[model samples]
Target: MMAGAQRSQTSFHFCHNPHAGSLLQGLQELRSDNLLTDVILCVSGKEIPCHRSVLAACSEYFRAMFCNGLRESKDYKVTIHEVSPDALQLIVDYAYTSEITITEDNAWQLLEGANFFQILPVRDACVTFVSNNFSAKDCLQMMQVGNMLSCPDLEKNASLCALKEFTTVSKTPEFLSLTKDQLITLISSDDLNASEKTVYRAVMTWINHDTRKRKKEMRELMELVRFPFMDKLYFLENVDNNNAVRKSCQDILTETRRYQLFPEEVESPCTRPRRTSGLREAVLVFGGLEKMEIGENPAVFSNSITCSPEPSTSSWTRVSRMKRKNDSRFAVAVLGTRNVIVSCGAKSRDVWLYHPELNSWHKLAQMKENRYHHKLAVVQGKVYAIGGRNLSSESSPWTSVEVYDRIQNKWTESVSLPKSRCGHAVAVVDGNIYVMGGLDTEYKDTSTVYRFSPGDSQWQSQTDMPLTTYAITASVLNGNIYVATLTNFLCYKPCENGGSWSVVVGVGTLCMYGMTVLWWESSHLWWL
Candidate 1:
């Protein structure tokens, strides 16, 4: 009866022995005992003896072939195609001992071998090794290898490297060797760093590489060049001087001329200049502390730095210092990728815009209100400076909202918040403005949430956050709002019956100053 009762419980505590799990135990004996390897793999005139069951278990390709009744299942000798024997041997060794060494020479071929056999772990490992060591110099070859093997992630990474370093990349032999289609795809990208004239120069170089052979394809390739984006001087000097423009390239050059002469005549369209943004995948963090210098607030702006997606390889290098001083009452926003505006609240009553790439500053019109603790957010290119407190007293909260028209260089008053609040968080999610958590007029902490749409004159109340606080950081991911408080992380699903905040468990964390939140492509929150 006791045994039956114990069996009915259906749960057991199982123990594992350390010796049995250790690779140090009896490996020499197992090496000697060699259970008579059932298969031989042939590659590059070399034969590697391996167990068919082990290889089949380690690879999906072999698994389906051996277990699903395929032709290769009964064969004792299998010939590996395309991959060199050294790489194949490494892959086979990994199958038996779960270990393999990847070197610079063998990394690419080893990855090809792993992918051919459908061994994801080794392939992923190779992908990491290749990409972490990637640079503009080797990116072309890496891109070719990745594309040939159909490894999309590696292909994208290599392309990003190439695009970011295009000026140097275009000078390489590989770029010159690219097929017409490949070159067109490259120059057609909006992210290319080179100017349209530079791209035109590159195209000319390619055409002149084997002019007689490539001339037939020149007109088709010329269409990919955005000639209107070229400087008027460069267009006259380069494009007008080219013999191809007078000959077969006449149609494309004519279209560009028409577009530039009459931009309103949209019969032919031309590409406009794009904002300069570094690193296709990255996070921009803005934060500054109020450092008192002998009872004075000096302008203290830190150097601008960018980090790569991989945190370990990144460092913050100072670019430029701030042009002015402020202890508080500061609000910041990004105006496209071209401008970063850092404005201070009342008493200072001024605005400054900085270009990160050029390290240049531009002074702009002042804001109407001068409240410190205000929050600034850019929604669809318009800067919205939200509620804040009076400079004289922290207790006096401002209910007013100011919208900055970047084109006009002026700020106009908009409908105020539902209540006078300060130190609140504002985020733009799916074209709607979501404002959450702040101290009310009485200087008491509250978790009140409000939202405003584009045409709405007044803010609408939403689900209150779980924590009561004057400060919170918000970001949007996968079409949901993620709000992190001083102590907890919460997510709000707008698609749900009535917006509600649900706790997301077990994402490790430490506190970040300024409470800046950004959505990472990896579906995790990046704090700055």
Candidate 2:
């Protein structure tokens, strides 16, 4: 019985044949000698003898045509249309031997044939060949071909190449051949990597290429130029005075003028700064008390605004100073246009907008409530001021929340917080507001976390923090909220385990009280 049981576990092992690599070679030799050739593929009046089994084994197109009980299955000859003879010959050779040489003169035809034949390996090889040979002069052509062949990788790479070398790509003849919609899509991309002036010039060049036909597209195309972000002198000299722009695009020109004259009043696509123009990722530190001198008062507040270009830079440049010297505990948030909004925390309703390009501060509409130690968050193009204590009111910790309306130039009340708290850390992820650890109305630290969505009447309570700590700072990175407390750095993943908190690193020794954490340059967290 034991022997029979052991026999039941016995199995035969099969090893790979060492000579299997020569099978394809032998098939190629058979095709060379025209031995047992069962099919002939005809392309452009040229015929090539091939094996039905080999073609069927290598190509889905051939398998579907020959093995699906179609009329072509019993036929000895098949005619392929819209494919060049040379491309067909190469594809047939590759099907048998798994190899083909692609040259510049033959790449497009080979890609088209491979795509038509549903041969993925050959199609991928052709895509790689074209991508490796991409240049500024022909990248637009490559992009068009990739689009035609439905090759996403090739199309994306070619598009990126054109954007990175936009100045040179715009000079190519292929650029002039782009359709009106294609031109608009290209210029509207924030990743164009060219100044607004260069984009404007490229539009003009395209217009002039076929002025009789494309001249009518001036208004539609000019809307994508972002004239407010362009150089002021260049806009006035080259764009404003140009006859075509002056004549047909007076309304757009008027909007551009309004943007230039009153930037805060205008919030349009033309006013948003592109990365190539002047928008950059930098660490900005707002109002806080400076380091105390030997004999200076510790209560002295600092109004200087400074920024570090990157995390690696050790030096910080003083870009601008706040208009009010006594501003402290101010809640700051960056607008969608990359402008910094500073709401005074010195028991005043005054708010200021810091324009990075002008290196100046402009006063914005005041808040509805006089509160200090409040938190600010920008969600969905609107700024929300969260909980803080009002000095004059007997109800010290106010639960009211207000949102700043750019169009109305005023602050209106939104949904209030669940609990009245100040010195809380706020961060926005996926258009939702997250309020972290802070001191409650009873002046005791609370570990409760609350999430609020716009247009919702109530804030949803989230998982409690690991520890109850106040004066914490929080920032969102990679869709996770990272909170820095006096003792440790914690991270909260909203999508993990129904939203949970975990300690990321121990920073108790850093004593990070009253510091703000910011995620800059899409990497590296700076505490200030």
Candidate 3:
């Protein structure tokens, strides 16, 4: 009993003290003092004194070397041939202290040594350091190292960084040094910043780096370029003469020409090798009040259309004209990036869908009610038409809502609003439909805000507006809704239950009733 109790007490004492800071301090001091050092690791004939117990605990290689009856276990000396002395020294220090500084100069070397020893944490740290410091100049090398060490995420990040800065990266010697697979990986990224022409030039340079070796890969590679987006003249004059490009992408070039000359006959080929994945979105405005000559008023049925990159940029270019006149009160909503659907054409049940790419309009199925002053918002790619009046019928303003599925090409009924209202603003945020302040059944502006989810049948009331004024337009940005009234702009926080509307400064005041308000990321593109 005494022997058993003594053994338990010793085991408990060791367990309790194993992770204490004092033990780490003692080990650090022991390392500094070179006390009880059990082994010497030689790298390139340079010796680094180390404790075998610390090495064995921290590294699988050292553990196997010390515990498996290896020659180094008896001799207390192991020669490392794969890594340099500097990397070995860093590894030895990390084994004792559990920390090491990884810089650009020594990162690859340390990673190599760490990988060889199966020190996964050290390898991860090296990868992280390289990933964070990636630039056009060093990213290729970083990617190469990451690929060799089996760190896929690090390799991906490094390759993407190089692709984003391809114009500069392509001029470097490292660009030519890229393996065929590595270059393909760079080109396959969604938003590699280089234009199609620059990419073609870069490919030519890479192939020319060693013509005998890289010539075979030329055809297989040129087929990946998005030639349709490139200039037509450049393809005819420059790219057509290339024997490799002509041979590899002959079918693709013919398709590109068919798309250009006979656009309606053929669907555009969509092989974007290096197209910007980040959206290059622009807002298109159609049919509002336009200024006329001094003696005349602007025609009611007139043509005025423009698309701006942002809400603030001065550069606005003319685009296709709306086929039908658009009133300020009519509901408008964008269905994905391709289709812009306009409904409730001022008491008429006409619904027009506009295609931006083709710059053409087609009339879709009409709504159940011939509603004007109605609200429309898109949730999960389906358009929801909510709360408006039917001017043709003598019915009271609509409190009912319906969803239009693009797939079904028809109107489907949804949950009704809590109260009858018109000219209210509706916004879709976090997959919920929020109906805000508008004229109530009594024709008075109501301060109430209600929320509705797709699956739910009831409209749950949310935080009301700070003021009783009707919300003219609303747009969501970063999960927060910005509600604009006739007099002021208010920001609504949906997460906060009570009195979430806070006054936004510097917006000044709205004199006229604004038709629509949208929230774009870059403020520079916003003109109105």
Best by lDDT: 2
Residues 1-528, model 1: lDDT tens digits: 665674456678887777543542344234336646666778778987766677777898888878887767778887878688888878877775677888898998889889988999999999989998888888988888888899988988888788778888888899888888778767766667777777888888888899889988877777777786688888877787788766987877776776566432222223334323232434544445434345565555443434344343466545555555434547776665446787775466677887776778888888887768888877655778889876785358888998877668899998789898887877776657778888888888888888876678788888887878766667767677887766677788764244888888544553334434332334456656
Best by TM-score: 2
Per-model C-alpha RMSD? 10.8, 9.4, 15.3
Query: In what order do the candidates fall by lDDT, top score first?
Result: 2, 3, 1
Candidate 2 residue-wise lDDT at 304? 82
Q: Write the per-residue lDDT of candidate 3 for residues 90-167, one digit (tens) a residue.
A: 988887778799987998899899999989899889878877878889888778877787878778788778878899
Against the hidden true structure, what lDDT does model 1 obtain?
0.72
Give the better candidate number (2 or 3) by TM-score: 2
- Could you tell me every candidate's TM-score relative to the true structure? 0.52, 0.63, 0.52
Model 2 poorest 10 in a row by lDDT: 512-521
Off by over 4 Å in 1: 1-326, 336-343, 346-366, 391-396, 406-410, 429-431, 453-455, 460-466, 474-484, 489-512, 515-528
- For model 3 the local lDDT of residue 169 reads 94
Instruction: Output the better candidate (1/3) by lDDT.
Output: 3
